[model samples]
Target: MKTLLIWCLPALAWAQAPAANPPGPWSGGLGVGNGLEAHATRQTGGHLLLLGRARYAWWGPKSGPGSKLFDQLNTRSRQTELAVLAGRSLPVGRCRAYAAAGLAYLLGRQLGDYRYTTRSSGLLWGDATYYYAYRRYQALGLPLEIGFQGPLGRNQQRLGLALQANFNPERSAYCVLLTLNLSSWGNRIK
Candidate 1:
């Protein structure tokens, strides 16, 4: 019985051992559905990272027909945010899932054009003219994100798919992004 128990222990240990290390810093991919997402992260420690990203979308409401109106009115209907994130990875099977929260700067604008009438009839129609105004609002936002990351190439590069939610005083927006970690650029750091 002792011999059988010892043999089983080695098998159990092998089964419970951690998976191999994921490819390093640079990793990203392309696909169809929403859009593309890319990111770069600098590791500060074993479980900490500083991240930044630039994203673009071509099918969203903010980028469609209404965009022309916003351009004409000198208002911005799109979004560009800069953020810093920190999170830790929890191993799940062969992959790692992470949850991160951070702060971001939200920048965008809105425009409207309307006419006001003093009377309901055509008599006052001449008195009303085109009224145009541009509104611009900028605020700091809180961003919360969760996603999974894993190895893609033979090197240290990794690919990540994540969902990011931005909370602002006025409104909130959600984005799905695919990120690539540029491990090559990261290795230059001493």
Candidate 2:
């Protein structure tokens, strides 16, 4: 019985041990593929995160038939998003797979180009001006993200890839992002 017990002890000890590398609590990501999403996230407890995000995208000018060559259609946008999220991480092979969902507040600002035509001293002058045409609105959104991460240099920092979707009554956007995660369980989760 002593010999059998000694053999089982090693296996039980390994089972009780944590993995060599674990996902951290702090994650910052910059997404750029078709569009851009810049976000920072910090874990509050074991499975909850608080996030602040900002995004900017250039949609380009709008064109149509019956429009002159000089006719301008300017559209651009900037946005800010805040969220409180909950998530769980599962061990997959040597890495961790995570999924999170949250409620978000989005502030969107739409920019447009203004065209001004001026006549000075009976001389006709055509001028085009590029300025911020402000159209700001706020909406509530649902944000979802799924991804996998692995430790880079110890369990303090990790590198991961994620796919995200942000949806609201006004618009819906998605992103494929690369993330750098730093563990915040010890110091500040900022």
- Candidate 1 lDDT over 1-190, as tens digits, reads 9999999987655444543453344333332224345556654334646476544423223443234433333223345566777777677655567788888887655444433323234754632222334446688888787877664333444556788777888446678876644454444343
Worst 10 residues of 2 by lDDT: 63-72
Model 1 segments beyond 4 Å from truth?
A: 1-38, 44-46, 56-76, 111-134, 186-190
Alpha-carbon TM-score of each model against the true structure: 0.57, 0.57
lDDT of 2 by residue, 40-146 (tens): 77654446453655554434345322134344334345556666666767767656777888888887765555444333353475444344446778999998888
Q: In each prediction, how many residue pairs overlap at the backbone (N, C-alpha, C within less than 3 A)?
A: 13, 0
The whole-model C-alpha lDDT of candidate 2 against the native structure comes to 0.61
Query: Compared to the true structure, candidate 2 yields what TM-score?
Result: 0.57
Pairs of colliding residues, candidate 2: none
Angstrom error of the Cα, residue 153, model 1: value is 2.0
